[model samples]
Target: MRLRRTVLPSPDLLDIALAFGSFGLFTLPVLIRGSGHSPTAAIVVLGLAATVPLSVRRRAPVPVLATVSLVLVGAALADVGFTVFHSNAGPALGIAVLTVADRLPRAVSLRASVAAVGLVTVAEVTAMQVHPATGQNAIQLVLAVPAWLVGYAFHTRRQAERRLRSETQERAREAERRVRAEERVRVSADVHDIVSHTLSMIAVRSGVARMVLEQRPEEALAALSAIETASRGALDELRAVLQSLRDAPGDPLRTAGALAAGPAVERPTLAHLRSLVGNLRDDGYPITLALSEKAGAPPPVEESAYRVVQEALTNVVRHAGRVATSVEVAGDPEGLSISVLNAAPAGGSPGAGPGSGHGLTGMRDRVALYEGTVAAGPCPDGGYAVRVHFPARPVNRTAPADRAEGKRRG
Candidate 1:
């Protein structure tokens, strides 16, 4: 069987310092006492082998521990002046065993610890037989247990810290994904509202212009002018929506700032309802509008109310045809209520054909944001009606300059 060679990392500065320091400490006593019976060179060489290998103990802990143990055993068997319990050998062996417990798997490190302890004990016993003075080495055997315990404790703490860090990063990623998804839904709703309203007006005006082209040139010209105006308005709104998308911040957490980065688009409010009604009137839509505007409604609430009315009117033009429509906007201290009702077509059912239903869905989504409610269905008189109510709330208006500065800081 082929055996895998374990890759070891190059020793760093700390490892180099540790190796040299251990070497000096281990050999200092020998230098002072002098080699008793063995040659001075052999004892120094044996001390070097036992301690210097500690430098790479973290990278190849098992091998380093085994090497230090075997060298200590050889010295004791050869009857050198020192035995396995020499000042240098005991410390070097403890450091190697500590590293094995810290860096290797528990099962492998446990086996390594047992083998090291056995090897050193047998060597010390053999050396004591040759020279009785070496029997004190047996006391150092107990040091291995505490070294392994300390290293294992460090390993457990490090693993726990790594797991906590991983979970925190995953949660941050999930939150970003959710924010981006909400932004997409909001953008899509804006696009649908703009396109649906504009196209409905343009389709009606173009047909009128085509029908009266030669017989009544003035009426045709007026219809064409209305179409041009609606198209331009649609283009401006679409450009603003596109700019918002382009300017969105890369980080989902900063979505509000990203939206604010786009060029400020003037959103429709209750004041625009008069102009909206006038445009439909010009297109020969038999419509009557009544407005009772109050000032304290928030900007978001105003915009949502405008969208609900716009979508309702567009549905009237598309599905109800040229029918009498009444739009009423009433406001009190409590809240605002809007109602748009269109009578049934001259000879057909109201909303008879297949419909996408996106308009109503978008309306519900917008109203839900402000804790409002929307009701729409066919009435008893074969007419269609949409009614919406938004509860009154205090407006918190921040200056444009402050918003812009916030965006810059974000």
Candidate 2:
């Protein structure tokens, strides 16, 4: 807490101000310097020591208070040669009370402060009456209440301000975290799509080149050239996206992959499952995809809905134990549905890839945010199943349904 308060702001100046105020705190003694009974050098020294604590008031309020309050009690009781604790224990009590309130918890800090004031008040009340039974003095008794109250108010305001500032910083940090996460999602999905698609194209080209290697050298070279171009383009786009998210000490907004060119979309939607499944089947997974709707014309409601399936399938292909897989996308008017089932990879981690574990949670957040429902769990048939249902109303919709339907039909 001391470092938090002292490091960011100008602590030296604050400390100096506090120390100067400490000197002023003993004004009563200076005023009574030569009046009748003299306050000796010892009392003056103790008064100065009390002021020394004010230097570190913000740095270590509790320790400062502990030392000052103890010294204050002694200075108050002992005659100290001739001077009587500068005839003012009121200021010390008040400052210590404020320090405790600032540094300690409400209950503990309050009890200590109340005890200080009560003791001072009782001492003053007794002092006022000669041979007093209560052992109090009048002057300090009258002063303690108002001082403690004012100190408490000041401490409360400062603490409140500190809390508000901390909250604002936390919110900003959370916003930064979300921005970074979104960037990762955009980039990861893009990379997954591009790499997977390119891999397919390259594999086909390579197979063709292998056949034509001896018969048609030029054709093989042409396919190789296309591969190079595609690879370079993918790399360029990936680099741009990464640069945008980097904090490189210069232009804060790295315009690597911005939406001006439209969102960095690479991931396949439900419509692309035919090709995706074909690739997997060719690769020996022997996968089949069955859809609830034969037409397969997914609405905006099934946009993120589609990504969830892609992710689940990707997981199955990479981690599911069995080679053969079944992907099903089906639903009624209420919502769309999707599920991917494959045997768990033998001893394969439940999630074998780079999902932040928050992916499912994030998918959950997306579903809830869009007023949709989704469920993912290990299926009873010894595999994993993920189902997503996006309501027909749509997460982002404004047009009248009748007009939209007429346009669609037209």
User: Each model's TM-score?
Assistant: 0.71, 0.46
Candidate 1 global lDDT: 0.76
Worst 10 residues of 1 by lDDT: 395-404
69-109 per-residue lDDT for model 1 (tens digits): 88877777776644223523457777887888888778889
Give a tens-digit lDDT track for model 2, residues 1-410.
45555556477577667666766555434546642333556556766677767777767766766666566555445533122333354465566666677666678777776676666555444444533332334454455456556667776888899999999999999976765565455456545645554554566567667888899999888777766865775566555445444443333353332434445434235676676576555444567788665324234334455556555656665455235677887767666666666765556543345445555665565455446787787767556667776665554431122223335457
TM-score of 1: 0.71
Each model's C-alpha lDDT?
Answer: 0.76, 0.58
TM-score for candidate 2: 0.46
Task: Judging by lDDT against the true structure, name the best candidate.
Answer: 1
Best by TM-score: 1
